[model samples]
Target: MDIDDEVVIIGAGICGLATALALHRKGINNVVMERSETLRNTTGAAIGIRQNGWRALDQLGVAETLRRTAILIHRDRTVSLDDGKVHEILMKGEFRCLRRKDLIDTLYDELPSTTVKFGCQLESIKLDPNTSKPVLRFSDGSAILAKVLIGCDGGKSIVADFLNVKPTKKFSFCAVRGLSNYPNGHSFDHDFVRITKDNKFLGIIPIDDHSEDEKKEAVMDVDDEVVIIGAGICGLATALALHKKGIKSVVMERSESLRNTTGSAIGIRQNGWRALDQLGVAETLRHTAIAIQRERIVSLADGKVEEIPMKGETRCLRRKDLIDTLYDALPPATVKFGCQLESIKLDQITTKPVLRFIDGSSIIAKVVIGCDGGKSIVADFLNLKPTKMFSICGVRGLSNYRDGHSFAHEFLRIRKDNKLVGRLPIDEHLVYWFCAHPYVPGDERNWEDPEEIRRSTLDLLSDYPKEIQEMIEITDVKTLSFSHLRYRAPWDLLMGTFCKGTVTIAGDAMHVMGPFLGQGGSAGLEDAIVLARNLAQMGSIHVESRRKVTVQGVEEAFNLYVKQRKMRVIRLSLQTYLTGMLLGASSHLKKLLCIVLLFLLFRNPSGHIDYDCGCL
Candidate 1:
């Protein structure tokens, strides 16, 4: 089957099918290779195709089929279980939920059989250097060369690997859904209700095919809610995600007030951008956020600054802004600021845990999520030990860019001796910087006091550039923070387990490592979305059915979450550690060579961007 000159598409999922349809509409023929004998039905679950997707379908002349076959959800209802408050939202444009199979079938029927090849899996991919075209090799030992190659093979894509852009796959959450035949209209006819619970989120929609006369019965004797520990970014994001799905959760922060002193700024790459955009949290922060353009690495030994080609939708924003952005998104009562965790007791029979707060109040939780920091109690409860420490420590600070500043909207990195320092401009008036260096064996006072942290920071950065030293001096003396850089080995997460029973961990609780790649916060944000999605699917029963959410359901979700996320986090942990080592090289000549090699290898930072998190 060796062929030449055609648009070759791998995988027949939504993206592939849509691309095929779009191309066909323009009178362009394409060859689609599907690994399976039949089209995938998105695991037999109903999924919502928003207005933008509907518009794409319209362009392909299949919008009518979709509208007729799917349920038209004109209105959406969100319920808060904590306060029992109902908020009605008017959806604009075409919003519908349909069986994934039905949508796939509609698109497939429009295409000619000659255009699609089933049971043809991609084994390897190559590009012709002379012709500059993509060459594909299939599992059946056949080959084809295409003018253009589109890899829509989902997470584990061979074509993506060929392009050197294969994503590190992870499932931070789980989703279990079922389709119900409702012959008659119920209370939620023509409407979609998103209900929040204690342990899970239930998204119930009324399908168009209702029976003429159906008796309405009460549904839900099931315990579906969650108990969230640690009201930090991860916890708040998780709470908001659950709330959006109309799931109930009690967010308990250990401190009496919102936690502060977050150590300056943080970076959110394309992955974080897409997640925040999908979660409806990115729009407002755009004004205050700085779009990072290039990464400037400085050789402190000779003061040679090299600018690497770094681009894409990378953003640097204040830590306070990120915390406030996530924290304020939730309803006022969603987070109980002063609710500290004193004791956790799990019932052996039900697997439900009773949480005792320091104030003497207690709540029994069916599912508990630990979003606490590196020293996570939930991790200990689940038998996940603290990450083994590396011989490095990290110090970070934020400075007031009171007037006009020199380094705004850039990610500047400096390497001197065995120390690595970075300055990222978060906004016009603020800058965030961090130093990762060899840890001192005996001196531990810097970990406690901010003044000592400043002194230790100065000692480490003895003869840095003037701007770098001045930024450290201008930092708020109270806000300087230090921590031991520790990481769970890749195998530790791959084989060492993350959850037990209904108790699990999210974000830093599950994978705590050094912040070398600046993806810890982004991953945490993504965790909120993934974990909420999986928990929501566990409660996707028909409104008229009496199916109690079980502990087994929660465990199934946790299993999928761990399985999906383990490898991705492990890859990120190793990349971050290796990057820290390269940048913290003690030998000047070795550092110069590594920087040159790194610039050549990772110059296009776009390849390192986080884009795959939103699809799940």
Candidate 2:
């Protein structure tokens, strides 16, 4: 059987579905092919919603929905673990978190149900070289013809295969996530958390409320409860974007929740803040989040601290608070608590792309977006391999004290040894901290054992001020987490040619970098919005219009996506790496250089940090 349309979409994940919604809003009707028989209830734990993602959601008319479900996070606080000295940084806006499913569901709600054809696995496409129309055949023996096709199928996209496109895996970092109930009256400020210990790192994001009242309140109500991975801040922001879109997401971890461990916090830059604002969660974030005004570097030998005020606006958010806001904004159906993607394969030939599940069922889609994270299937399918640009380690956690205890007001601190430490306020009663150091190969101690990790971390910080030790001592092993840090270069051969025919990639699929600059999810969301707009402007999907839909058009758009993104992503990645390097510097000369650089660059209070959203 054969059908015709103006366009055919190959996946139904975030990018795919968002593209569909965008097209539909533009009055472009098309068939959305999915490999799965039903909408996926479980995706990943959480994702960061930077300005780009929020802009896309705003175009979709669901920014309010997302805001309703997400908690606004706006400030960044960093402090010395030894002296309780603080530095504060302020932001133009903030970010939030939501479960993966919540975001998916919200996007799904905005589309026509009949537009998505499930269980139709793409087998192969016979492109009429003369007209450029694609004849799609599915594993289920279904067929269709379309003037244009969009792969939005994710990093492991068959469309990329058909087009012979591949992405280079820039880095490989596995993450574990979980969620838990926030104790009643917990009163933790709504914020995202980041912490570092020795060279290990962990992050915590608060999600929507877990109870009935939370379930019924506006998605933005701070009561929504959920937690995400203990890794970094990007994933948590992605989750917030989804929830703001009115989808419900839950982050299920292999281990216990971050509340049970120590976590890290990071500063949210304007790039990410724009994402939260576009989603309409910026107001809430601005109210409860902490502002980071400066970053200080202390000389280990002389105990002299040099202060550099932040040039641009930034916020320090508790990781958990960001996650909880996203969780609250989403629909409950959005997330699958314990489900994991074991394996994936593409149908050889099909009008619609098909994904075979390990559960013995198959999913057919117009596209499959792989937000499955760093070790993404979409990235693998595109043949993207991880690159080793920078490798490091980090440790992090939260510490509790009396309500009146005064701590550092700033958000980030670097030592003469180049070790980096930061603190974020979760509430008046608690503070989160993190540490980062250069990776030393062969340092294999079980990091999962909180006790062992804590002992090692404290020993490493022994040279720090006594206040830092006091905080560490008061913080039990149960409140700490650890992990290695790795990053990839922004531009890669694979990302240069990310799309083939109807398939394309987004998020970590195209570019994966270190989390220091916090633009990972921000970039992905930008990709989604740009791709959606391009597809919307392409018009109908019918065979008659196929000739008018030139390969040049698709190529041009894809190229533009890459060109607009490359420099920005590269700059952010490099900035993050530089921050890490400066923190981990070993030599006196290097430390002095860092100080000089800080004074030269960061000393200016009027300096501006610009990030282009590529909306133009």
Candidate 3:
């Protein structure tokens, strides 16, 4: 086919579309020639639309529409990496980091529907001898004779070649940019920041408020160096641990917001306290709970009592407090909530782990850490066996004494017929209590209702002391929860692989164990500290064209993490397993063996709490 146009713009990118739109506004008929079958979508990251840029958009009658999509930049700051110096200037006019897609889509929508011609790859161009017009020949064996040829065809323009223009120069360094979305809002000032070291540069511009829906759309195919798959204590702590070492990571959480906030509390022994201190949150969290001075053990069957002095710092913290503290300590956009991971596979080209979410969005990460609990998708990707369940389930809740109870700063454990219930004060007015008992045949159905869980727990513990019963009765129904105790076998941790390529597991995902020894949360925190330490030792992380830590570097860091944490967690897991076994054992021989093993392995039950994970 042959066509004739008064004005033809090559390329359908921002320049070509804007040009076409300008010509359309002046009532000058024009057409745009796009080589690909569809508009360019993934060619660029973000464009800093400055004052003149907005003015051009205003002239084209589209500035007002684009203004609503992004935040305004109030200041521009330049950071020099050589001497660690900084220069600042207040922006005189409007500035923003406008997404390329937003601009391209806006321009395309403003133009006439028939203005763009897709699948039109230009082959050559020549001057028509008779009319002196430019003749455009396409690879599809078609031609167009236009009075004017505007070459907006990006870097390699055929029209520019025909005009004998100087070719574009190639540079040694490349630039790649992306937008980081903060669903809960960002803490950065409305500034456009540029950090430069020699020829390398990084730009950070504040965009508009990112909502949940927009966050899901904006990070569809983004790439990150490190991606932590859960936002719980372990995941967020790991991110913060890395952040403490000046490393950035993306935390993908499945929930809409922070979860497990009911009434569950984590006992932070000396080890967990050491990890929190390394993450720089220990001082703040310590004021939230009272310190335990001693422990009390009571036998309901024989009315036998025992007391032991606590050797180190120990406190019970609400799970919500820990989660919120860790989350608030991280930078903006570090954690992306509502991101349900669908599956994970290694990319064929880069061998990096590619995470696919249920929303059809995916991310390619240089390092993937599975902190998504025992049933982690990343662990499944690593082909680790699913965590096995114990014969018991645990029910936990928080009780409030309006008048402030008269209990001392002590942990009390009462046991009878394989049923154990413990209570510890979080503060003067709130008490954290839990019960671990044999799993009933139909206890799974009670998981959805807190009332049923409370009732079942009360029924199971009916033979306990009256004060314990009263504490359970005063507990808030909303804080009641029933969960099956699940753990990865100690032998599995010894023989099975916890890491493959640049992927590894942490927290409950790597070593979930019974809470009898009170090491699950602490062990996870330790995992965070140790993992971050190993990774930071590789080298400084830079957001340049490529990551500093290559595939081999990631593997080496993960191997070190697993190697350091393997025996430590194996010992912890084995102790917790034997504790559960001793409580649930039916035969006298089995019980005796568990007792003998516990005596042999850990002469001091609280000795594990003394080990420190070291500084970040």
lDDT of 2 at 30: 75
Residues 23-52, model 1: lDDT tens digits: 888888788899864566546567787899
TM-score of every model versus the real structure: 0.59, 0.52, 0.65
* Local lDDT at 399 for model 1: 80
Task: List the candidate numbers ranked by TM-score, top first.
Answer: 3, 1, 2
The whole-model C-alpha lDDT of candidate 2 against the native structure comes to: 0.58
What is residue 83's positional error in candidate 1, in angstroms? Answer: 58
lDDT of 3 at 197: 91
In terms of lDDT, the poorest run of 10 residues in model 1 is 213-222
Q: Which consecutive 10 residues in model 2 have the weakest lDDT in total?
A: 221-230
Model 3, 45-154: lDDT tens per residue? Answer: 67889899999999999999899888998888999998899999999888888877678888999998999998688989998899887889986557888888899998
In model 3, the clashing pairs are 71-208
lDDT ranking from best candidate downward? 3, 1, 2
Judge candidate 1 against the unseen true structure and give its global Cα lDDT, from 0 to 1.
0.75
